[model samples]
Target: SSPPSYQNGLWGHVGKTKTPEDVDALVGPRPGLKGEGHLFDRLSKNRDAVVVLDEIEKAHPAMINEFLLGVLGNGQMQNKKTGETIDIGKSIFILTSNCFQTMITHRYRQEKDDVAALESLHSSLANTIRTWVHSGVSASGKGE
Candidate 1:
């Protein structure tokens, strides 16, 4: 049988990974970072790779705002500790989360309109994502 996709390797309980150094370990580290291999580099070697990041809401905020911005925005991950950049333009990352479900259920539980609830939830989530993307100290020069 074919092996599971590399995306299947993410460890749970991501809140402990506090900084960019921890972010490098979570994404996978390179020799330059004092580690053996990088998942982004490995996946990029494939002609087509779909990377899945499950439970994204649980990840450390620093990793998202600091490390992930470079990769998700520019298709390049700059490992601040190692001063190495890994090219991730070829991979597609699917991020999944269940965090909003509870809020949606509780907030609109009394309402009977499913469509409205969904729309409201979408707007809230979009605003939250916008805040997270722009909350950093420096603005991203590269346009999305």
Candidate 2:
């Protein structure tokens, strides 16, 4: 695996998180004398970053509504302590949730039905990837 493109872009796993506030507090700007004093603020250093909110679904819906909708949609996040606007225009945010990925074989009781669902999802994903790859090839003529 190659290194991350940005300085603090690629975070493999953040363990079991419980909230989006937890997400930002862990990665966003902070208060104190100097301001913008957080791990991400220092690590990203005004560069484009990728923040991965692991186990995102574990967070309360209100936090998701407030946090993700606020920062990601607007490319800004405010420091919770001082309400200072933090710029994330060049940042890339990605989230992952194992609790959300319900394996078909695990979701259902009937073995055959589980297999069917697995096949269906796999087929759908394959088709979507194929179409996306084809479109990229058409556009760039590099994936042929």
Candidate 3:
């Protein structure tokens, strides 16, 4: 099997799980955000996934934090939008960010209360990519 695809906009619409009755539905997934779905979650769900978020920090800080915690591991997201709450169930999450150092610093700075350790790990991986880029080993290292 190849993959599935959703033809909506960048961030697809929230399903009918949040029906305007549940208080938690109003809260959404990303804490205080309105629409409750992560772009990474959406992309990961696609069949032929090639997701790329350039400056990930520019997105809702809280959303990013929530995503780093909830979805990135096994690509699971709980959407509290439908007044009831729904889960993406399965996703193929891929993320990119420029705030590599910042995330790491924040995680190390608050190891006790940091819920985004995986975010820190992702940032560290980004740093590794940067190192590869700087050392000219990322793309050109393929024997050129």
Candidate 4:
């Protein structure tokens, strides 16, 4: 299925989130500033916004566990610096990755039916993501 269209939102690339401060820059308040981060700033202004995090697989495990888990699970995130909160209950989050593109492409090519191939890919990807989330490690066996 295709991703939903959003009239408002913010986009971020995880390649830039190599440190805790980077995560804060995306989701929390900027250091030494009263204003919110890019994502939170947009979210605060537009409650129905969508947030797209590209290359999510590249984010550090601490970011996934400490920051994303809170935002995703609670639909809200707090700025540690400013002691402010951003409610994301009405927002949508889209996480994109190319972690297993080669394997997915190979599997798709091996399948005869397109529907079946997509279904299989979906299931496999879901299972892999579940494993990664539970284990706090990625396919490359590197994370926390």
Candidate 5:
């Protein structure tokens, strides 16, 4: 279960990322703002909090390769500016994306069997997302 005001932590406008600094702002403490980063600050206040990073596919490559890899792989991240280690082991992260919505919808409409369509879509989406994440290129074939 999530907190009632979980919407407060929604990161809907995580726009283009040009540098590591942008990644820091999302997961680590900001450059000059002491102890202030969206994910870090939310987890610091409430370990049970649920944070949503909407449209994750739009995030920069550095964000996926650097911050997300560390967080998802290790369950923790170091605050670059504060030199503090933030543990995300207890926090719930919800990543949302519409990368293949159209394809999925079209497949479902064209396919007669629901189970087969779901299986095919699942396999395709998984492989595509895995490739995009590892190769630093988005599903759109655009390098961020």
Candidate 6:
């Protein structure tokens, strides 16, 4: 078969258009960076899908809070190109991080189900946050 075609803004057309080639092409030239571009772009485009950024402890602490706020605020983001604001109103955003605790607890409280497994999950989550916060270490322990 022919090679992938990551031309224009075509990477965002996954599942709705052509085959895997289209999806592969979407992962542009810079295989490392551009490959993830489609994922971010699609997450931003979807109106209802809730994209969860797991293992967020890996991100810088300063940015982690802001990132959580943005995701929770319905994909609220700033466009560097146009210096404008954008929102994924239809999407529900959730970010899991290793630092923050209160927000996660608040979110957990909002959930309808109180199953044992769910409670255990929240407890584990809170314990993780406590560990990170008390240790005064960034997720990477890079020491700011």
**Best candidate (score: lDDT):** 4
> Per-residue lDDT of 12-122 in model 4, one digit per residue for the tens?
886557876777667664558554466666677887887788887788665688777778899887766777887779888888888788887788788848897789789
Model 1 spans with C-alpha error above 4 angstroms = 1-21, 28-33, 78-86, 112-114, 136-144
Model 2's lDDT to the true fold?
A: 0.51
Top model number, TM-score: 4
Sorting all predicted structures by TM-score, with the top scorer first, yields: 4, 5, 1, 2, 6, 3
TM-score quality measure for candidate 6: 0.38
Model 6 misplaced stretches (Cα beyond 4 Å): 1-40, 73-75, 94-124, 127-144
Per-residue CA lDDT of model 2 for 19-85, tens digit only, reads: 4444444454234434332434443465466666555444444335555566667887666657666
Give the CA lDDT, 0 to 100, for residue 126 in model 3: 69
Residue pairs with colliding backbones in model 1 are: none
- Regarding lDDT, does 1 or 3 come out ahead? 1
> Each model's C-alpha lDDT?
0.56, 0.51, 0.41, 0.72, 0.66, 0.44
Q: In model 1, how large is the Cα lDDT of residue 48?
A: 47
Q: Candidate 6's residue-wise lDDT over 8-77, tens digit each?
A: 2212222231333333333222333223334435545554555544444454343333333444546565
Model 6 CA lDDT for position 13: 22
Clashes of 6: 1
The pairs that clash in candidate 3 are 3-47, 4-47, 17-82, 18-81, 18-82, 18-83, 19-82, 19-83, 44-92
Provide backbone clash counts, one per model. 0, 0, 9, 0, 0, 1
Give the CA lDDT, 0 to 100, for residue 98 in model 1: 69
Candidate 6 or 1, higher TM-score? 1
Error of 2 at 109 (Å): 15
The reply for model 5, stretches above 4 Å from the true place, is 1-12, 16-21, 29-35, 138-144
Off by over 4 Å in 4: 1-7, 29-36, 114-118, 138-144
Give the better candidate number (3 or 5) by TM-score.
5
Clashing pairs in 5: none
